[model samples]
Target: MAKQHKIIHVDMDAFFASVEQRDHPEYQGKPLIVGGQPDSRGVVAACSYEARQFGIHSAMPCARAYRLCPQAIFVRPRFEAYREVSGQIRDIFWRYASEVEPLSLDEAYLDVSYTADYNGSATLIAKAIKRDILKETRLTASAGVSYNKFLAKIASDMDKPNGLYVIRPERGEKFVETLPVGKFHGIGPATEAKMKQLGIETGLDLRNKTLAQLTERFGKAGHYYFNIARAIDERPVRSSRTRKSLGKETTFAQDITSVTELTTKLLDLAEIVLESLAKQKLNARTVTVKVKYSDFQQITRAHTLDHSIALGDLREVIPMLLARTEAGKNPVRLVGLSLSGFDAGKSEDRQSQLDLAFSDPF
Candidate 1:
């Protein structure tokens, strides 16, 4: 007999803005914007619930957000604090089940089918977890209990800001039929518009189309859409997975064309790569440098180190990589640095070296 599946989705409500309000008593009850500086060419990272009432949201231009809420308080983001809180939240999830898949800093899915205390039911477990978060973090969380990740994630959003919802296996298909297409995860604005054009505005409309029709229209994604339309998601909740590669890339605001300036940008990119590696406990044996010209043409140059590479080594190697470039070329528009071929053990050894290098040997 097939085992009854048990999954829970937990999402923090307005995570970034809520964190800001929690730390700053003065920012409470007033509209607050957290992102880039308003004076600079910055975008809104997040805004408080009050700011949402004024149509301020993430990815909106800071200038536009300011215009919408003239008296809004704007502050720079504290990512370190957010990371700390995220760790705490994940630790809380661990008490319930070890099979937790973190989607981001503020959301995760847990499979508790084989839990030590399965007698209580998934819904009860979710409610207990939410209450625990509020008690420990002084923050609110919304939880959804269901038989699969897709339905659980959708149910989690049904109730927001300290909400608890459940999707029973028997009612799953009916619940999905009434759901709007836009509400489905991975169907962003562009896909939603296309779905609307095909008269697929609701899950029911999506179910009406044959799988072949969906595949013809949406390609591989069409298959996923068809399954989701029927509320049948069999994907497992993955807890730990090996990372294939580590890299970072950025698009320039404007094209740049100078080796000296490009070198400077490479330094910054290397630092970002190093910090990410440090957090992930990874060290790379291969360093790849990416260059993009004004015309959007791109090329990559890579160097393999004899031993695991360090950030300082990357700083020294990047300029040499740039020097190998053909002398007579246009100014580069963007520069990126990537470290791949990570050795988990090498990362720990390198971290020890770093610690010793900075230590005061008396």
Candidate 2:
């Protein structure tokens, strides 16, 4: 007899806002917003469930969010602080599974099929982890348990803000068939609208379409949709994935035409990219500079480094890359800096280093 596969998806609910509330008791039970400043042409990063009552959501303009919930507490995001909490939660995950794939700062998938203790079932493990997270971080996490990645991800979201849902292998297919297409992870607003236009509004609608039909309409994505509708997912929880690229791009409040102004923007972009690389503990062998002109024309320039270069190195290189461009011909609307071709270190390597260095020796 083959062994059953047990996959778990963990997601932090309203991560940023929840973290802010947890750290500041005064903000508890209030409509808290974590994002950029309202006056700085910023957007809401995340809003408490309370704020959602006013129809506020992530990426909504801060000004609009403020107008909707004028009494809501708006605060800028602190990535470093969030990263600290994330690390603590990750450590808790490591205690249960060796194979953990973090989807973002606030979510991850874990494969515990090869557990050393083999005590209890997957649901028990999920429950225990959630309890530990709440006890340790004073934060809530939702857990989804299932036989495959797709089902596990969906199950986890079935209930939110410290909820847990499970889909056993025998019932996985039935569960998936009844799910709405809009509930699927990759089906965005655009895709859902297109699916509706085709008279396809549910998983059953998607399942009714032949692979050829779906592929014709959605290209490669169509095939993926078909497979997911059937609850067929083969992706594994990968723990060794590394940072693929480091990049920064900025949209301007106003466009600039002068070479000197473009150079200044490029320099700023280089610094931002460098800071990201340092945080990720990565060095890149390739440098890519991208520019979008006010006319919406886009161009890119790339240069390979003889050795892995640091952010400081990029500060010097980006100006040279900008100088090489024909700047006077077009006014620049956006500038971006990207670094690819990372070395062997894994994505969490730098984070682990920081954790180790900061721990007390007593």
lDDT of each: 0.79, 0.79
Residues 1-362 of candidate 1 have per-residue lDDT tens digits of 45667899999988888888976788899999999877768999888889999998899999888888889999999997788568657756765653789999999998766554435377777877887677546679999888889999998999887899998888889998999999998689999999999999899999999999999989999999999999989899998754545555554655776677777778887786677567545668898888867664667888989888887788788888887764127767556677888775565654554343211100
lDDT, model 1: 0.79
- TM-scores of the candidates are 0.66, 0.66
Off by over 4 Å in 2: 116-120, 241-362
Q: In model 1, what are the clashing residue pairs, if there are any?
A: 257-331
Give the poorly placed runs of model 1, Cα more than 4 Å off. Answer: 241-362
Candidate 2 lDDT over 1-362, as tens digits, reads 44466889999999999989976789888998998776768999999989998999999999999899889999989898799678668766755664789999999998766543235367887888898788657789999998788989999999987899988887877887778888999899999999999988888888899999999999999888989888888877898553356565665666878877777777776776666566445677999888878776678888888898876677678777877775667788777777888777464763454243211100
Model 1 vs truth, CA RMSD: 15.4
- Tell me how far the alpha carbon of residue 90 in candidate 1 is from the true structure, in angstroms, after superposition: 0.1
